[model samples]
Target chain A: MGDAGKMNTTHRRLILLLLALLCALTSGCRRDQDAGKVRIKFWTFPLWTGITGNEKDGTTEDWPRLKIKEFEKTHPNIKIDLEVVTWQGGMQKLDLSALSGTYPDICYLATANLPKYASQGILEPIDADMTPEEVADIYPNVLDCCKYQGKTYVWPWLCNALVLAINVDLFKERHIEYLIPKPPERGWTYDQFTEACKALTFDRGDGHGKVYGYALYGIPLSVEYQMLTLVLGFGGQVYNKEGTQFTLNSPESIRGFQFLMDLLDKYKVVPPGPAGMQGGQVGQMFANQEVAIESSTSGVLKQLKMSAAKGDFPYFNAAIVQPPHLPGYKPASMLSVGGYAIFKQTDARKRRAAIEFARFLTNEENCRALTVIGQFPARKSVGNIYPGDVDMGVVSRLIPISRVYFTAGAAELNPVINNIYQSIFTHAMTPAEALADAEKKANKILAQDALEKGLDAKGGKQ
Target chain B: MTGQDSTLKRIIKSRWAYFFVAPAMIHFLVFSVYPILSTVYLSFVRFNLQGNTWVGAQNYQVALSDSIFWKSLANTALYTMVVVPVGVGIALFLSSLIFPLKPSRQNFFKGAFYLPQVVSAVVISMIWLWMFDSAHGLLNYLLSTLHLAPISWLGESRTALPSLMFMAVAGGGGSAIILYLAAMGGIPDSLYEAAQIDGANRWIEFWKITLPLLKPTTLYLVVMGTIGSFQVFTSIYMMTRGGPNFATNTIVYRIYQTAFEFLKLGRASAMALILALIIIGISAIQFKWLGTEVEY
Candidate 1:
């Protein structure tokens, strides 16, 4: 009897050791799994939330109110812990948690970043939890960005198509009344804009006018988004119609490149030399009554309105419109989105809970409320419910017509575009030369990817 | 039998020595050896969207083929070339000047110069970026007094790298100055007397004895300076963000772009490994060629 008792005690000790290791492996797994409740952790990028209503406790007030209200209505026993992270350093914090095997259940990051984390096996596939009908609910083209192969990674939260903001007061002062797109069809053609900007530019002899019609930021998104407007306006796309092949080297694309150059050299609408000054500087110029017409995101309009409400930028009476077209082309605007993703590390139970939470977050009412925090909702239903002084009627006009430029290999295309701009703007390469070089380099990269996948051999789509 | 028992006891006695050595050895192995070896190992792999996988020398091949990596390497070389000597030279000069000052004044000056050494590089870079602003900068305002046009210090690609070099030279006052000062203190005054008796002028004595004596310190400063300059991310990031174009992109920043931003960890590892080898090679050359000889 004594011998049997000792063996039993030893076995118990070994079992405890194994349990400790299992706990360590699933680092964030709660010990009290049978203890009557489920807990999920969620993170939000602070930048995703626009500075809302004047309250010191806005974050605490807003997050709890929504989370509690939704949870009480849906799953009263489920507990949610909300955390906020800034865009600038959010990834690093998450990276540490991931490395330690204690990552959050769900996180809202830029959808563009989905590929990187998904490849790391840190993010859970959304398809495993959600049905095909449910996946269809997200905005088209956006779901493509979040998926790697056939696996869904995140819910597409917001649609933020780039809308041009032109200062009407400055335009009127320069007698360039038609530059501001007050009416839908009556916007400036490319040549008209060029001539108008030339007329607006008055070199004040002593040092000349520092004012510019367009102040483009040096970053890739700023360059690409604006270039897409120019590219599509001139009948160009980054890829062929099916997007399986690269066609950025086509003659149509070259025309688009030439137009951007002509804006600086022939038209004088943009800043001189290789310098890149952003819309913030442009906005300040508008506030000081310097520039007439500029291209920027509509998000800036909200910021301007907030300042206008406080009477800070009193003269900043700017209006939003679709980006101006070339003399004869379809109007085009690119979209930028902040993404929300559920990780692969998330278990079945947690993944379901995350998907359920995502549905609650993107439901028209909550999505509209989310945008009050400063995000643009992806769904038209949410836009219809948007509560603000601005005309949602005008906002709805672009919903049907708007499109997100997408390709399976956006990751490869983005860097090449940045390289092309850097090379061309710095005078290291010319416009046609840069385009050709980018195409050649990009095709090789795509070919290598295809070869690695053995897609061509198998007759599979890239 | 008693002799055998005592021999076993002696072997047991040395067990305490293992206890003494194990902690430090384990710490070094875990922190230094493991990281370097893992980086070297990772550099050979390839990471696509699916995940990282072993792809023999593909990362290295790609890194070598990449123009950006080469450009960043060249930028690092230029930065090190400019900042290392200039920083060390200025530090040497300041140390020499302060060495002859009265004791209390010397201490005060030394402390003042060393204060910046304690503050972080990010703080220093931020302050300099504000001062170098093209529109509302103190540097431009100061230049305006000379009836000269204001310079766009960081805004222009041509001038951005040089302005960073200037910041490095100017702000290198503290730790370097103290190192040189300590070295100067240890130099025997008797040698100066012997040189003085030989009718050598101040410049000759300085060149002949003082300069030779300063070699070890100079070697140390140069190695440290070069290593610091090669890893010039914080300043570039805090200010120019690798360009007006890719002009300011350095090896360290490129690694950051690849590993952290782009998430090509394998390629980033290769780039970082190459940089480490270059730094080690340069330091070895400096030590081999110029490290001072010692007398017992």
Candidate 2:
């Protein structure tokens, strides 16, 4: 009845109006959809972004925009929405997306992650629509990486092979040319590699003048990827034939691991404090000519070339060679396959569109783009993509012997591998002790994972 | 019957005030409260992307039996034990030294200490990475000058956790100093003046007047600092990554790895609940012990 009462009534009405406006504004902001057009959300990491067209253009969608535009010309009814995620923590992002039922229609996945994603039933099978001829074109080794339970879940794209890259100038300076592996020869034996390392390692009187034979990142993940070469070359297997048990503690594997430790402790040819170093640091040391040899991969090569172009890198003449193997054992290299996977979609049309786009992306014509990033096309028909380039020529030759470093349950095994290296480098455990501990922990985790998946301890169906 | 109004009538009477606060309350419930409740629910289930199955206390049982979990808890406890008290003491000491200075001088010191607080934790950890580098780090360089054996600050199990603690003690006092300074400003200067007039020396006056009055500020710092130390992940994630054989691993880092990396969301939730309960228990103990003496 009074002035204050009138003010209160008016304020309440205003607040109600504002609240209604807020609700309407939020609700109206749903993602825009074009009439009669199927929108497919595509997510990818910066794979193949080293190509000229894939460079950033002030948007996250740039790397794959050209390809999308080409695809859109033929498929008028389907629209592509692309989001490029970073390699770091991308798997977690994918996991979260899958959990929320908001995953992209298509995304890039690695072989390491394929097992987990495929087992979750979040991925659509790629083989369902593939022609027999199309399937046969892909390299069997790389293509097999995409399969789970006889169904292909990923469209094979590229094979990432890691090899030993030695500083040619350092070898020349040490007069160890004969020790380097030349063509027509398989890699040197462990004794030969050790001899070369001793020869190349030298100390200068200046404070900054020590050049070690080799320097490697001792972090667990890096060890699993880079140092696994030693394990494999020494005739060690990460898992038993049944994929049931950890076998890195076997005598052969222990010998391999001991050789790595000996390189640091006995030979003292590697720089100190490898336990604290990261992969990038060792790469930098190689570029800076502080170390003689490094375990180099296609990704590292891409980085090195980019740095050189930017004039930010200390340039060096490098040669690719096979990692040293034990006598009577074949030399081996680690390969990580990169590929595109289509997520399970409710709409049949959207699923078809996704498969078509995936096929187009991996076609022979577009496969050449992989060369820019130092990746080998997954299709054997694509063949010798590097052509005349000497370094890649060596890598192409090595691809036949390359093996997938990670298999099912890699997420569980990798951390254990990392810890074993850490324990050894920190002197907390000897090589044999560390490997035994790793086997124990990894087996428990793998067994638990297998049980959760309704499988036997050997990763077999019950 | 004479005093109480009907619920609808009471709500109508204060309808305008309630409307003004509705947005904030809704935001809190959606972002904070809902997630917490979800986590608690999830702690009792085995979460799958397809569906979550109820498995009460199994995740907790797994965590309790795991040796790494216990090690991580002990590491977190050790980190909190060293960092929280040391962090509070540094803040108190710095605040006491700066409180008597001119406003401009106080602001200078405050800004200097607060610089790390403003800089991203990732950037600070990167800088410390260089400082802690065993072969080329500044600390090793300093030791080399004195003809002492170089220490692997983050590469060795014994030194990794302590190195992190030192970093925390050094860089963690900025916000606490600001809080302590504000608390010190609120204390009537007459208390210090009366103590001085009664022939109490500076040290005696500080021990009797300044320190005791700062109890409330210290209590807040200790509780918050303890919580912060227990949740340490960035420095470990960025610098050590719980490496050197898990010497630097903490509860939060393990939880993050479980939920995100390994996709054991249910186990992560259970570990999180356990952590929450532990923090709550510790906070309660802190309040009981320190809250008894507060006067302001």
Candidate 3:
């Protein structure tokens, strides 16, 4: 008892000493918030620059240099330490930095991953800055994904809507008549698509050269846009009327996966083993003249147009088509956005400086300039610039007819859907097999969130 | 003895030695001992971004059942099993190969083999990841030339573990090779000469003489290799991310992801404690296996 008493006294002293030390350290950092030049650290992944976009000498994308100059001019004293990260390790890097509570002033993340971060209180709500007019000025479909629980943490920027790029020269040589029936003015059926691709396909005989019907790059979610767009075209729904309940195992989503798989295994119209190539590889194949029709994001459109503007590359006849459709189908395509958010830093000046720099970078002018690279405007007045004078014939005709799948504040849904789609396409899991696996996994993620935070953690339908 | 004069002198002499050691001892306790003890304390608690609390046994419990923990453990076991003996074995073989060479040639070859060890593990792992990329990677390119179907070295689940192991062996080349050469250099040239004089061939001299002398160095390498391999983390984080379904997930990676990503601090701590225990246990086995029957 006497020894125990002595131990307790020693422990108490140790605890008090440690508390004093921590207080001294934390207060030292937090208190420095009051004074000092605002040092706003910005972290970002390179926006879709092909391997060549080195900002060092302006050989490729000069975005970093251009944006950095403008940002520094606006916030003269705020030292913006810009750190470039890679996509493969981006999320984990952000999470690790955030957990330290010493993250950069601003960082970019996919809009898909935002809700999870925001709900964790790692993201600062942008609700205060966004007036009703600002909300109206932004793409309603894009902005709808940024809000969570009537508050918003992120403002969407640099949107990438997928499109279909065709090798028009191949169509002309094959004597195949290709038509992009403009949406509302014209509608597309699945039969029309297959027939066009079939006519374009030519087998040059064994070991000589082979041209398959259509250059559909499969190899998994490389075809997600085509799948979702076709599903909406077929008037199929991914989720229920209320977004809370998942209906991935429903007939519509299953049919969507089935139709996608059929293009590869059944029709033999897609390239041999559409499941073997990734999205970018497929795009490169189209550029190299290995594929005829490429389903790719608009981010690549600028480059494709750039090459076209240069001269007979991928053949001069190449142009874009609006998202393809299925017969009796409504329009739907995957919606995605990549952008940055200023974290709530312990240093108030640094935080404000970072916020200011982020504002300078994402302003109307930068957004307009970014459009030349196929980054859609996040602001009201900046009109679309297609990197060319001519229109890619009849793009996203079903834009009005298509549905948006965003629970901006609720991120759990989209990734789960993506995971399902990837599994089916890559592992060759049947639509039923993939849907069953995804539904269970998706529900568990939601349940785990609900259990940890509270039932209301998933306020999707609510 | 002049006892009356001697007492203060003795005290002063002893105090001087302590004064000399005090700075280093203080540095050790502050930087080394304290952080380790703190981690142990953390393992008993629920650690998080802001603060942690003592939740004894809970973290341990979560680690006990985690599938990722077992996968990581299995990967470590496989790595330690492969790297320890093979690392020591090749070190021994290379030493024997160089032992009879001209002094100039011996040094050049030793330096060449040890070169890879001098390079950082992170840089080496990055190169390996590229070499292992499923498509458009160098490995695939080489395979294409051979008219073989491309093997997804890093991308495929089955090959990820083996790919990292190969890199580990290659990078692990440096330290063990040098240690074996030093051991070989010390084996009095007289012993080999004497054995050869007795009509023993080169192979006999190696197996009967050089190999036995290397026992101590071999033991040392075995213990160190086992300990190091059991704690592998950075490779998976850089390359496989324990994926294609938990193939390359090592214990350390699982612990880190668990604590940091999942935010299950208690669970993560538990996993770490288990890893620590496993490392200790494996070290014990290594000692038993490699322990020499020396007079000392």
Q: Which candidate is the best by DockQ?
A: 2
Give the per-residue lDDT of model 3 (tens digit) for A94-169. Answer: 8777766767778876676665566556677776666687777777666655665456666666665555666677
lDDT of 3 by residue, B1-296 (tens): 58956977887879988899999999999998896776677777554443454556655765665544676788879878887777777777777788779989988988898887777768877787667655446887798789988775654445667888888876676778778888888888888778888999977988988788888888888888888888887776666555544556688877776665555555666676677787788778767876776421
Query: Which segments of candidate 2 are over 4 A away from where they belong?
Result: A1-37, A48-63, A184-186, A220-223, A455-462, B1-5
Instruction: For residues A1-462, write the lDDT of model 2, one tens digit per residue.
Output: 899999999999999999999888776653333457788998998664434534554344554898898899898788998888887777768988987888999998887787777766789987768899988888777877788756799998888677888888888888888888876343778899889888888976678857888885655442357877876787888877556788878888888878888999999988777777776777777887788888877556666666787798666677777788777877878777878899988899999989999998888877888866778888889888876776777777777678755566666566678888788888889889998899888888778776666622223221
Weakest ten-residue segment in model 1 chain B by summed lDDT:
B44-53
Poorest stretch of ten by lDDT in candidate 2 chain A: A453-462
- DockQ comparisons of all candidates to the true complex: 0.19, 0.25, 0.05
Each model's TM-score? 0.84, 0.91, 0.71
- Residues A1-462, candidate 1: write the lDDT tens digits: 698999999999999999999888676555454246566888876643323555555654365446556764677556777888766677878866664567788787676566556655677766766667656665665565556666777777676655666676667667887655555433457767666677666644564246667644443432255546755677677766545567777787788777777776667676543333332455566555456565656566677776677788574677766666765665766666655677654356766777777767666665666555445676544445544434333334554455556444555456566666655655566778988888887776666555544522343221
Q: Tell me model 2's lDDT, rounded to 2 decimals.
A: 0.82
Once fitted onto the true fold, the runs of candidate 3 whose alpha carbons sit more than 4 angstroms away are A1-97, A105-109, A148-150, A164-295, A303-324, A345-363, A379-431, A455-462, B1-65, B83-91, B118-156, B163-174, B189-208, B231-239, B255-269, B293-296
Candidate scoring better on lDDT of 2 and 3: 2
- The C-alpha lDDT values of all candidates are 0.68, 0.82, 0.63
The residue pairs that clash in candidate 2, if any, are: A220-A418
Question: A383, model 2: CA deviation in Å?
Answer: 1.6
